[model samples]
Each structure stands twice: as C-alpha cells, then as structure tokens.
Target: MQQQPPTSPDVSSAAKSPLFQSSTQYRNWRFSVEQLKATRAALNQASVAAIRNTFESDSPGSSSDVHFLDANEEHLLVKLYIIKISQLCGHFRFPEEVEATGITYLKRFYLKNTVMDWHPKNVMLTALYLATKTTNHPISLESYTANIPRTNASDVLDLEFLVAQSLAFEFAVWHAHRALWGIWLDIQDLPQAPPHEELQRIHDTAMQHIRTSRLTDVELIYPPSQIALACLSLAHPEIAAFWARSKNADTALEAIESIKRTITRDGDTPSVDVVREIDRHLKICKNPEKVVGSKAYLAKRAREEKEAELKRKKKAENVRKATEQGNPFGEVLVGQANLDDDD
Candidate 1:
C-alpha cells in the first residue's frame, strides 16, 4: 500500500476538522469550490441590489419601491421554511427540540443570507444536521441520508457544508417555545405540570409566528425570547389574564412592533398575500404522507380516537361487569338462596 497519510499526533487536540475537508482534497473539488464561490458572490450581489432597491422608493415600507419579496416569492420562501423544518423534524427521530433549533437557524441564516444564494431545502437539511450535531446526538451524514426521502437525499446532503459555513459553524440556537411556556406558566399560576397538548398547540402556533416575524426586524434585533413572547401574544389573545399580569409583556410586544416597523419601513405593511405565498411554497415541497401518513402520526391519532371511544365504551362495560359481580340483593331479600330451596 502507498504510504499512509500521517494522523494528527494527538487526535484529541484538533479543533475538530472542518466538515467536508476531505472532499476539498478530491480531484473535482476545484469545480465545486468555484461553483460555490460564484454562488456566494451572486447572492451577495443580489443582497446589494435589494438594499439599493429599498432606497429607490419614496414610501419606505410600501410595496411600490424597495421590496424583499413580492407576494409569490414571500409565500414560496415561507413554505420552504415550513417544509425544511417539518422534514428535519421527521428525520432526526421526531425530536421536537432539534426541529425547533433547525427552524431558528433557518430564520437566522435568511436574515444574513438571501433566498437567491441558497435553496431552502439544502439550507434546511444543513440546519437540521447542524442542530443535531449541536445537541450532541451527532447523527452521521449517512444516517441523515438514510432518513431523507430518497429523491431529495443527495440534494439535501449536498448543502450541509455550505449551511454550516453560512452559520459559521456556530449553530447554537434558542427557540421561542420555551420562553413562551415559561411566560404562560408564570401568568397562569399553575403548578409545574408538563404542558398539555393545547399548550403544545400554542407553542406550535408561536413557531408559525416566528416565520412571519421574519418580515419584521424582530428576526434581526429581538432575542428569540422576545419573538416567542410576541408569537404567544398573537396566538392566545384570549388569554388576557396571562398578559395583563405579566410585566414583561410590554417589552415583548414592543419588540414585535419594532420588528413590524422595520419590515414595513423596509417595504410596506406585509401583505397577507405575501404570507400566504410563503406558506404555500413551504407546504408544497414537503411529502404529505410523511407528515400526515407516517406510522407515528397515524398511531397517535389512532390512540387518541381509541382513548375517546374507550371512555364511552368503558363506562358501559364497567356497569355491566358491576351488575354481574354485584350481590343479588332482591333475591336475598326474598330468601331464595338456591333453586333446590325454591323447588
């Protein structure tokens, strides 16, 4: 065999190899490198153009002049975020924490980068993988590939390194979910019980809020904690009790408004049309069956229905069994101890 390449004298001392460092040494690496560099350059150019376009219009936030995305484009972008996060959620063994982390990174990455340079799907998987590694679970690239939908596996994997590079390999992301839960708990004065499904729904809704919040400066300025609070505010307005007593609500609300101002000043009151467009794009790229038809989803649904039906059926069953096992008070009262005695 040819001489072996020398290992690092102390394997433990390295700062950890850059992802894809080996691939960079491959013969065709130059082509991939040049392509990525050109892509990054193009994206940077587009970002500049977008900023310039923002200044051209007399009305800052109006749709007439500087716009980030038209209705169709915005919808498409949002949809991509949804699909990416959903798929990541599915892949990393349905770990909600990892899914949340991936979504947070996507939003952050978009704030710095743009839709022009990186496709959302690739960026999404990259975020997921990065999140996984960050959480210390550390699934290998092969496991990711195996979990990915066969059709999109390679494409998703291809973007992993670039995604890492975009985030500068610092992918520690905090979600708004926990912050919201804390607020909810504190305001409600409930004991330290786990959040019920309804509470979980609120968190899920807050997540969607984060997506829309991207249109505002909230993504850029406010911490995730504030964003999570804003999301909770929007999602559970009926919980006036929760907001009224919470001192921090004002701060959270202000962060949201500030984000809205930035977004609007950046362009216009974000059109519902734009939000819808983004939502649609995210949903389309996802495999419906994996989300809706997966065994886990189906099983959960089935269990819920079974439990409900059991409640109804169990009452009757218990009554019937009680009647069978219970003493015959009427017969005892008549002193009919046995058939032979009656005869």
Candidate 2:
C-alpha cells in the first residue's frame, strides 16, 4: 500500500481538504463576497451598454428612454427563476440532484452572462433539462417538454449548448445534499446519537436548509460539506454542538457558524411582488438580438451567417490553392496550370 499523505493541524474544515480543493467548484466557481458583487455589477453594466448599442443600431434612439434592470434586479429575477426550477422539478418528479444541479448551472451561467441576453425563464428550462441528463434523471426531451405548456423541444435545445458553454462544460457537481446525507450517516455511529425519529427530523430539517442555501451565495462562497454542517447547525444547535465537540473541531464550528449566518441572512427568496417588478422591467430591457423572430435577431443571424459563409469560402480557396499550386493559401494558379485544370 502507498503511504498516507500528510495533513495540516486544522484538517476539519472541508474547504481545505485536498480532494475538494482540486475540484472545479473550488477552483473555478468559488468567489469572495466582494468579488461576487463586483462581478455582477460589472457584467450588468457591460450588458446594458451592449444592449443599448444594439437597440440604437437597430432603431436609432429606441433605447434612449428605456430603464434597464440593474445587477440587483437581474439577481432578483434569477432568484425568481431558481424557485421555478424547483417547482418544475417537482412537476417532472425529478430527483433533488437534478434540481440542485440545475440551479447551480443557472447561477454559473449568469456569472459569465446576463439575463438580458437569455431570459432566465427559457434558460431555466434549458438548464433544468440539461441537468436532468447530467444528473442521470434521464427524461426524454419530448417527455420533459410535453407537459410544460408553451415550451417545445427547440426552445429547450436552442440554449442547451450555450448553457453548457457558460458552465465551462463542468457538469459534475458535488452538492450539499450529498454531504448532509454523509454527515447524517456519520451521526448514526456517534456516542449518543439521537433516537431514530429525532435524528430523522434533524436530517429532514437540515436538508431543507440545504435546499434554501441554493437560493443564497453560500454555495459559491463555501464547500458543500461546510454548507451541510452549517445547515445542520441551523436545524438543531444542540446536536450540531454535540457532533462538533465529538470531533474536537473548534475551527470547523466557527466556519459553520459564519456560513449558518450567511444562509439565514440570504436564504429566503424575495417576495413575489419584488421579483415580479424586476421581471417586468426585464421584458422591456431584454436584448432584442436574442429575441427570436425580432428584426434585430434576424439581422444578427444574417450577419453571422454571412461571416460564416465568407470564412468557408476562404477555406475552400485555400484548399484549392493547396491542390493546384502546392500552397495552402494563395490566389488560384493560372497560365500553364489553366491548361491542366479540369473543366
């Protein structure tokens, strides 16, 4: 057998674990409080400018009087849709992993994109559809969209690749629910484990908190295991304290406290009215270039197709030059070569 690896003095914190630190979640998706704010604000600003330009170009002075959605409003709208993902999952009888992974994908997509370009309504559906596949919930495309009125297979598929791209194609997510389950199993073997009924209640309550955490920034800020413990701490402080003391994890308890506060502070979804208002503004400010059948979308597609055709023609020219002149890229051969050229 190979030798065991060395660990630090404070090894209880999940964020510091070697396995988790190497995950894409820790490396690519993690962010500080300030960084998350700065990123959203910057993306919102850039999206506003780009959409305004597109509107101006399409219909001069069209967007001059429009009130665009700010970063906070965009976030509220996304939260609204996150809740929708859960409802949809329930409707489809999807597993919690699919729901959670869908939410994570939607969040990651908005980090690198804006709600204006792709409405969260459509993207939420697409993300959940993609999540169903990624999480092994295996619902057919027709079956998935059949019951969702006004949604067709194309509507879900159109943004599927785009969502995948936004997530950097990292579909595997280590979720807090799994961690909480693991912790629950460990709690079973504890010195004075709660009676079966009490332990089950604690597990269920903590699992609810884990679901609530998906509505907050804790998922991006901390590892799943830390979030799980924090949720457990929230559900039943006495049991959490007992578990922590059992493990002699002082620092871990401190971090759990901090994350517990974060979940409590930010976990609740905004009121329906508040989110409804943000969503109302979103329709007016949404990017026309992404709105299918809009003149701007048609124009944008035409331009993209033109550019693609040009690139293809250029490649063909290069191929012809290579075959005829022994050069990868050049004007077509003529003169003596013309005599040998096939009709």
Best by TM-score: 2
lDDT for 95 in candidate 2 is 86
**TM-scores of the candidates in the order shown:** 0.46, 0.88
> Candidate 2: misplaced stretches above 4 Å?
1-17, 326-343
Q: What do the candidate models score in CA lDDT, each in turn?
A: 0.55, 0.88
For residues 93-198, write the lDDT of model 1, one tens digit per residue: 6566676667656755654565543556567777777777777777767777777676356566667776767666665555555666666666445443235777
Candidate 1: stretches off by over 4 Å: 1-75, 78-81, 91-93, 111-117, 151-158, 190-217, 238-244, 248-343
lDDT of 2 at 228: 88
Worst 10 residues of 1 by lDDT: 24-33
Whole-model alpha-carbon lDDT for candidate 2: 0.88
lDDT of 2 by residue, 1-343 (tens): 8886786665577655678777888889999989999999999999999999999998899998898999998898898889999999888888889999999999999999999888898899999999988988888899888989999999999999999999999988989999889888989999889899999999999999998999998888888988988999999987787777887875788888889988889888789998888878888999999888999999999999999888878866865765765644344443433554222
Give the Cα error of residue 182 in candidate 1, in Å. 1.4
